[model samples]
Target: MKYDFGEAIDRCKTNSLKYDFIEERGYPADILPLWVADMDFKIPHETAVAIKKSAEHGIYGYTEPKDSYYRALSGWFEKHFDYPIRQEWVLKTPGVVFALSLAVRAFTKEGDAVLIQRPVYHPFSHVVLNNDRKLINNPLVLKDGKYCIDFDDFEKKIVENNIRLFIFCSPHNPVGRVWTTEELTKIAEICIKHHCIVVSDEIHCDFVLSGHKHRILSSLSQEIADNTILCTAPSKTFNLAGLQAANIVITNPELRKQMYKELTRTGYSQLNSVGLAACQSSYEYGEGWLSQLKEYLGENLKYIRHFLAEHLPQVKLIEPEGTYLLWLDFRETGIEPSELDEFMKHKAKLWLNSGEIFGKEGLGFQRLNIACPRTYLEQAMIRLKTAIDSLL
Candidate 1:
């Protein structure tokens, strides 16, 4: 492999939020930090070289994204997703989190409702409420250990709440289902009918593991594309979240105008210089590295599935179709959410995301980020098995 995903890079002294803040976050100091979505792998050498080239210039002046930046991004989207996006449709932002917040402001009024599918990335709920908009949750239905959209409840919420916007997570976080083309089309159709401005956060789009293909929400229909704010970044895919580069693609003239206006009003027009360089370099040259990383992650997912089946029969992996995150159901273990948290913290000495934080529906589940070296994953699985054995 051209890039090393197995090498254990020490992150302790780097002041990484995932690594350096475990004590502050009330977790054991020695606990493996898999709660945050960031990976432990080194940034691809090509990306590192690009950042070094920029740093050698020694001028940290305010900067804007160059034409090359746009080309790199547009080319990547086109190549990977087969979705042709115009450069004019692209708008840069510091992060996808910012993009979601900005979309909340741009599309909805102060009191209008924004609907989100629960057991989603936690930030989606906060983005709506933080902007003084009402958060209407249409929780997904989990049947036979697979999660699917509850279309009945979704339509019901839209009608009852008069939802003005829908924040959709494609290649969804935690549960990790890559919505199929039919699913995307149906979701788009529902949003179009209700006149909901759809904000499709596709940050995890590039992280879809083997056998799962991503369907870009905008590619479903022109009507959907026009109404959709498609957000993506190299952050999750390339492990460059600290660099904070993300984009929002709006094909519709009016929607684009509104987002641009809101962005300008907030003085967020300029791109993060380091972020832009990382984004451009990663999209253009990190393909080989990403390919290997996905292959390695596929192994990790397989190990997890087999490990759970062999050792912890009560806990089930909700078969991740995409994303490095694994959603594990502990409901059969009959552990209360609070008891599970204590066991995970003290007994397992692991810091995984408690599913309840995603939503109340997340109870009886925990999210495990598998984007780490094999040795660490082995240790995690062993510790988890020990903890569960003690509980039983």
Candidate 2:
């Protein structure tokens, strides 16, 4: 059951977004890509075996998920987090991002105000604007390099704008934070008071680090659950994002009805045969693989912490309670945004997500994907050290 995470798999010729799109991304070809959210590791062996078996039939006909697929989806939730999700509550979707847009269309009006925390996943804003909904920013507060909800500001925005919906990022991205039960309670109260429907994106829920547990926002209370639309997938956990599968869970009967109606209106298609096979195999047999991978990622985070401390002392490493993405604060490096981008591209030969893409709050911050082989990580660290040295 020992997985080979250290092996450098060749991904250049495979039409990889992380590899083949460098020129399109306006970065030098030699720059190592650490920008995309997907990891460089091979998909789980169990998932691969299942996919191959499903492909052997050689018929890519239209398909619907069998009972086993439903069981796998519900069983994983029940077994791991003890969250009981009935079969009736689950709605299949091709992608979480697509689901977000669908939820916006389903629940809100064209001009309805949708609130999103700043320095959040970039797509949250993109989807809202594209769907003709007014975007409201309730930026997270940076206190001691740890990000927390500005609840007072959140309440203010809800009241001031008559915000119709709130899109939340649990165990939030970039500045990784697993919102505690108390925080969730307060947030749920505010959303309820404002009569705002909540769309909680918990896609990265399972990849949390030690001492942190993911709290499903809807599970906190019945009223909160009624108004909440929960989105999740096995993509990040099992490294099967290419499978193009995700679940939209709504426990409230009326809300579920509305979402399904929207799904049909949008002409949302059925899940692919391979996606179903991969999801079943991953949910059933990929737990041990995930557990070990988390351990490896913990070590990777620790290595980055030490590297920054010993070498690039000017940069701040915000310790994450969840997710493999390391949010680096390079403000102290005093490099302009353009100069920093150049350094990462040319001098360091690394490609990380520019924080500015997230929001203005992300200025001088960069999100580094550390979910790769140790050798690759070490090389990236060396490049980072050299970049800083050149600046000095």
Candidate 3:
């Protein structure tokens, strides 16, 4: 089936955080928003039908996933990445961040140091700090326009801080470099040697661009698998964030038990019926839609690259290898890191995730979600070019 990637959809007044809450979020009412991670596209047709069917059943009571759910979930990982999943290893959660918070409480005590790579998804830091754990950052280094991990610093930070828990963003958020196998191996070896538990967020695993591949951290080896907690969900892939379903894969029995106990302590159980229905059906039947979406996104990426070079030369696009979010560097425009937000909001009349929110390393940078129609990007680029022109 041919999907309409350019279809127009009105999201305003739908209680959308990205659309309706602009004024509440301290941005001008008329500013176009491309900040939040959710896509502007609609969910796949199969997923919608499954959700509608479940919703019409009338009993929206607490629910647990059956064997069919496990088959569909495991089937996806096996089919796409050649990573097999065991039924017992799966633990359903409300979302990945929620599961991360539970992992923080499960794996480490208060004041224990937890490590993360900076300029990552902000919620990583939040899960650590809000849980009363000490936060340690090993910031990624930008080498020749691509982000790379400083392995020495990563290991040193773990030893110096006595870190036991590390949150890793795979195919990384914001600055989108998919980790090669060599990179994944070194990380796994260091974490294993240091006895640091790795909570690997592979939420964007399915969105790798052409010429790159996403490797599951735990799939490296049995030793690494024992020390890893893999976080995944169909929310980002299928545009079902509102449904609130995530799968936390833990190969280590003890670690799985610990996290599940912490989850139970919070009195949270059973994913919503509609979310379960949507997730299973999407994984089972939405592959055709996803394939076409990736192709559309690839074109959007090309358009941005050409648009920036031709018109907005001052803005540097940090070439992305995965995910729809593009990290844009505005430092060349001579805009002070502190003033970039104001400039984007008031001058450009646009709403994007300020780089500083990710970390100090993100200063003078902005994360733009490009999972919308090409027309949206066209309008955003015009507004940005006009804004930059006014500065001169």
Candidate 4:
């Protein structure tokens, strides 16, 4: 690989949330942070160069994306994801979560229900509930260690609660499962029938593993496309989350207007200066880096599987079809949710996202981010094994 995936870069003193503020997050300063979604990898060389070039110019003014920005974004999607994104359909945001909150405020009124599938990204529920919207969850069924959408429960709840907006996580977070075209079609069909607007979070869409293919939820059909708000970002793909850049794509003019107005109320305008450069450069020049990173990440996943099999066989790694996050099931260990969290935090000295935070169904599960250097991952696993062995 041209890029060094094994290089361990110390993130301390960088004011990184995942690195610097471990104690504040309730983990020891010495804790191995394998929790956050951001990767330990550096941004592509070209993307770094672009940001550096802008910084050297010494003009720190509010900036917006030029034509090149849209071309880069559109070209990348067309080439990689097979989704043709029109320039007009794109709206820039600081981050996907911020955009999601804006979308909730725009599309749904307070007291209206918004549907989400759990265990999902915790922020999905946060955005809905924090906005005073009624949060409805149609939990995903874990069958044979793979997560499947509950289509009947999904539609039934939509009808019963009069859900106006649906936050759909494609290539879902925490629990990684890339929705197949057939699954996406069923969801779109439900949304269209229910007169619901689908806020499809496609941020992790680019991270699917070898066997699975990511189908753009909106790209399935025109009706789906018109009813969809496709939220995407180069942050997770290129490790530019600190720069805080994302794009929200809306094809329907009416829905687009509603979202745009909502965004304006939040006093949000103009993209981050460095973030735009990082995003454009990454899309135009970072595909090779991303391609190799995906392979390396697959290796990381394999390492985790083998490590657990040999050491902590009681813990099952839920097979992930996409994303670098691994959902580890510890039910066989007979650990309760709070106890499991304590074991990971205090006993293992490993900082991981407690599964119950995703939703109640995620009890006895822990989400470990495997997007870091292999050496650190090995250390984390050893720590975990030591903790488990203590129970024996």
* Best model number under TM-score: 3
> What is the number of residue pairs that collide in model 2?
0
lDDT of 2: 0.88
Please identify which of the two predictions, 1 or 3, would achieve the higher lDDT against the true structure: 3
Question: What are the per-model C-alpha RMSD values against the true structure?
Answer: 1.2, 1.1, 0.7, 1.0
Worst 10 residues of 3 by lDDT: 21-30
Candidate 1 or 4, higher TM-score? 4
Cα displacement (Å) at residue 231, model 3 = 0.2
TM-score of structure candidate 4: 0.98
For candidate 2, which ten residues in a row score worst on lDDT?
334-343
Instruction: Supply every candidate's count of residue pairs whose N, Cα or C atoms clash at under 3 angstroms.
Output: 0, 0, 0, 0
lDDT of candidate 4 over 195-309, digit per residue (tens): 9989999899889998899988878878899999999999999999899899999999998999899999989899879888999999999999999999899999999999999
User: How high is the CA lDDT of each candidate model?
Assistant: 0.88, 0.88, 0.94, 0.90
TM-score of candidate 1 versus the correct structure, residues matched by position: 0.98
lDDT of 2 by residue, 325-388 (tens): 9899988887886577777888889899989889999988899998899888899888888877
Model 1 lDDT per residue over 1-392, tens place: 47778899998979888888877877787887678899999988899999999889889899987788888988898999999778899998888989999999988899999999999999999998889999999999999879999888888899899987899999998799999888888888888898888999999998886677998999887888998999988999889999878888999999999999889988866776788898899999989999888889988888888888888888989998888999989988867876887778887998889899899999888999999998898999899888877765
- Expressed as tens digits, the lDDT of each residue in 8-85 for candidate 3 is 699998989889887776778789889999998988999999989998899888788999999999999999998889
In model 1, residue pairs whose N, Cα or C atoms come closer than 3 Å (at least 3 residues apart or on different chains), thus clashing, are none
For candidate 3, list the clashing residue pairs, or say none: none
Flag the better candidate by lDDT, 2 or 4. Answer: 4
